[model samples]
Target: MLKQFCEHCGEETEHKEVIKQKPSKYGKSKKEQFKAFLSGFFGGVASQVGASLDLIDRYVVCKKCGRKKLENLGDEFQ
Candidate 1:
């Protein structure tokens, strides 16, 4: 978390910056995926982690108030 001023909270608070990934619903269903993972331990976990790294949306969310500010990856972080 980074200390930043939140306009909504009207104070400086901790903010969580997250690089959003593709939605889970885009491919195999959660229930089915879980069952498939049960077949292999490390391999299954590794595959899941590797596949989900396709990130898109980036957001900085305030901890004090649930407000989100969109950020671009190309911009330098101040």
Candidate 2:
């Protein structure tokens, strides 16, 4: 239930939620590996040691003009 001001439509319009995955860094070097090992051993949080990263990119499309744009709608959007 997020409303955004659409430049294309020149008015406020309802937007839809869009989830996108960001490209993750490829490969972990030896140093990174050692750090992960140490963190796992000390912190005991090894579940996602080297998992690929994802980002939630919020976007809004003008229902009237169909213009797509990136928008920051705060935590509720996330």
TM-score of each: 0.47, 0.46
Runs in model 2 lying further than 4 Å from the true structure: 26-54, 72-78
How close to the true structure is residue 53 of candidate 1, measured as C-alpha lDDT? Answer: 32
lDDT of 1 by residue, 1-78 (tens): 598888898999999996654344434787766654453344445434443233335679998787998764442331
TM-score of 1: 0.47
Write down the lDDT of every candidate, Cα atoms only.
0.61, 0.54
What tens digits encode model 2's per-residue C-alpha lDDT throughout 6-46? 88778788876563433224237877666655644554432
Query: Candidate 1: worst 10 consecutive residues by lDDT?
Result: 47-56
Predicted structure with the largest lDDT when compared to the true one: 1
Q: How many pairs of residues collide in each model?
A: 0, 0
